[model samples]
Target: MKRFPIGILEFLTWTIALTGLFFFARVEGPHAGLCPIANLGLTWCPGCGLGRSIHLFLRGDFLASWEMHPMGSFAVLVIVWRQFELLYLIKKQLKSWQTY
Candidate 1:
């Protein structure tokens, strides 16, 4: 089997994450009602409100974002870092393959 520089599954996962972020940032208010846990009679889960928080953070509402979820900004930073790392890994893999 032959493998390309970037795998389809990995590319799709990042694309989905970015797409979700784009929509979340544009939508108003907390959309947590769509969460399965919310429907399961749980008022709040550990990850509850994180999506809105991230959206707020992306919209420059840092204080409001932190108020919604303290780790929201951190999570965003981590996601960005992960993307960079993925690119780096792909580059390294391609370089190694070229030496074969």
Candidate 2:
């Protein structure tokens, strides 16, 4: 099978992640995410509520998003910025190729 380029792979991964977060259902009580610390049976993890926080942020619940994780909004901004960066890189690469 042909392999996907790194840029394409990254773009797809981020797209899927954001899309999933957008559709992620709100959960009450404990967060059931794939956090290694939580999986290790620890009571607290710094990154635990990030996904839920992003989900809440996407759904326009800023206060709850902040409550879920202080960096959630910032994380969203970074992720979106990364997406744009990837697109710019891809566009730059295409333009360079056209010059050859």
Candidate 3:
């Protein structure tokens, strides 16, 4: 059996993750997050609220999304751009293989 290329795996991972985020509802109430730091009784976590932020941004609540996290919209754009970049790289790699 042939192994899958890392680029393909990465693209799929990003696609699935974003798709899930796009469909899932925004988390409500306190302590609803899965942050390990918050679970550990720490109140501050740099990465906390990022997922909720993305969810809000996807749902068309830009203000709420920004309130949740400043980089939410930017994160979405970067992820999408990376997906396209991965596709381009994967296509180029396949073309290279076809020449052999």
Candidate 4:
């Protein structure tokens, strides 16, 4: 197997970390200081409201999630799929290296 890129691992780490933070916020209620765009004094962001939407979707409130952000559920699904793909690649690489 070819060497796995360090950057890919870094990216995957951040993605997983952010997803964990989202779940934490969902359980702990809204963390007002968490949104970088809002903290930067921006009135709007392309991903504004997505966190709330995802939380709702995770809690089985799909309709409310869609009302908050039309594509929130789909975005979460894609993120999950990407994470799985990354993990699969990492596992395959390790297995091949062990055999060699």
**Listing every candidate in turn, what is its Cα RMSD in Å to the true structure after a full C-alpha superposition?**
2.7, 3.1, 2.4, 4.1
In model 1, the clashing pairs are none
By lDDT, the better pick of 2 and 3 is: 3
Comparing 1 and 3 by lDDT, which wins? 3
Question: Which should have the higher TM-score, number 2 or number 4?
Answer: 2
* Local lDDT at 17 for model 2: 96
Least accurate 10 contiguous residues by lDDT in model 4: 21-30
Rank ordering of all candidates by lDDT, starting from the highest: 3, 2, 1, 4
- Segments in model 4 whose C-alpha atoms lie over 4 Å from true places: 1-22, 26-45
Q: Count clashing residue pairs per candidate.
A: 0, 0, 0, 0
lDDT score for candidate 3 against the true structure = 0.86
Give the per-residue Cα lDDT of candidate 3 at 23.
90
- lDDT of model 2 at residue 51? 85
lDDT of each model, Cα atoms only? 0.76, 0.84, 0.86, 0.72
Give a tens-digit lDDT track for model 3, residues 49-72.
899899999889999999998998
List the candidate 2 regions with Cα displacement exceeding 4 Å.
1-6, 29-31
Give the range of the ten consecutive residues with the poorest summed lDDT in model 3.
1-10
Residues 1-100, model 1: lDDT tens digits: 4477774457568768766875655445444466788789888887877877888887788998899889989988887777788888887877888777
